[model samples]
Target: MRTVVYLVIGVFFGIVLFKSEAASWFRIYEMFQFGSFHMYGIIGSAVGLGIVIVQFIKRYKVRSFFGDKIVILSKEKSFYRYMIGGIIFGLGWALAGACPGPMFVLLGAGYLPIVIVIIASILGTFLYGLFRDKLPH
Candidate 1:
């Protein structure tokens, strides 16, 4: 029952991504190139909403849908580690023209070539997990 509900939610999110053109490579390219504001507007709105929700969660002691307490943890700040990670992520996004989330959506939308991107993402994640302890915190 829970699995079905989660699947439904995931499908709905994929549909929204498709409808919003958030999964479009062209939109991503435009965002990186500053060719248009459409994608940026979408990203900004999501960030604003996220900030509001996070604040509310912190202030109101929000619980999960399943009744567990929500916990937000603070991590130690590392400037150089974060900068390097961000640069690599940005370069991957520009080159692939899709982030991890939307890459799945693209695969579901029948863009078969995105399989390579998805596979590469999975391998990258696996490698990260294997080497995470060796990396800077």
Candidate 2:
């Protein structure tokens, strides 16, 4: 089933995250403080890989698991929207000591305290869904 496939993929991804220290609070702290380049290197490599993957998808006309055509749409450019959103995201990351991507991984890796961050993330998402239409696009 697709659920099994997704679970396997998630396990592999979580192992990668743990091994790469992407889920480490210390690594995140270093990134925020500019104390080291380890996290930056990982993040930069991921970004570079993403660019290549996107190009490949576009060139080959990749399809989704459900067989739908994959579309990469560009959003309207907005400086202030990105600036404010980035500030809020950065503040949350700095405060919670982890990026949104690794919160669940942290919890799975025996970090019981990350439940708060996970809950807060879910709540924030719910709030966004409730207010997305009212907020600036």
Candidate 3:
């Protein structure tokens, strides 16, 4: 049942993204180019919904979907780290013409060059995991 729900959610998101013209690198690039608010609007809506949902969970003292208790971790407030991470992410996105999620889709669509980006992303993730504890907060 959980797996089915996951599959359904994944399919739903895939459909939404496909329909929104979000999977196109050119479209996404255009959003960044022309001061277009389309992408920003989509992201703002998502963030707004997420904030409301999280507030509802907090207000209701809700635990989890399966009745498990929730464990909330404190976020590190490090402006420098965030700036550095954003710069790296943006550079990769601009260079590859695909962010992480879209990279997989592009690869599946038979763009073989995305394999290198995927590998590099994986390595970066692994390295981050390895050194995260040592990084300054």
How does candidate 3 fare on TM-score? 0.82
Q: TM-score of the candidate numbered 1?
A: 0.94
- TM-score preference between candidates 2 and 3, better one: 2
lDDT of each: 0.91, 0.91, 0.80
lDDT of 1 by residue, 1-137 (tens): 77887899999988998899999999999999999999999899999999999999999999987788999988879998899889988998999999988999998989999999889878998999999899987
Which residue runs does candidate 1 get wrong by more than 4 Å?
Answer: none
Indicate whether candidate 2 or candidate 3 has the larger lDDT.
Answer: 2
Model 3 C-alpha lDDT per residue in residues 45-131, reported as the tens digit of each score: 989998898788777877876687766556879899999899999888877777887776766567798899999999999999999
Each prediction's Cα RMSD?
1.2, 1.4, 2.2
Candidate 3 stretches greater than 4 Å from native: 108-112
lDDT of 2 by residue, 1-137 (tens): 88998899998998899999999989999898899999999989999999999999999999988798999988889898899889989999999998887997898899999999999989998998998889886
Order by TM-score, highest first: 1, 2, 3
Q: After best superposition, candidate 2 residue 66: deviation in angstroms?
A: 6.4
Minimum summed lDDT over a 10-residue window in model 3 is located at 14-23
TM-score of 2: 0.92
lDDT of 3 at 75: 85
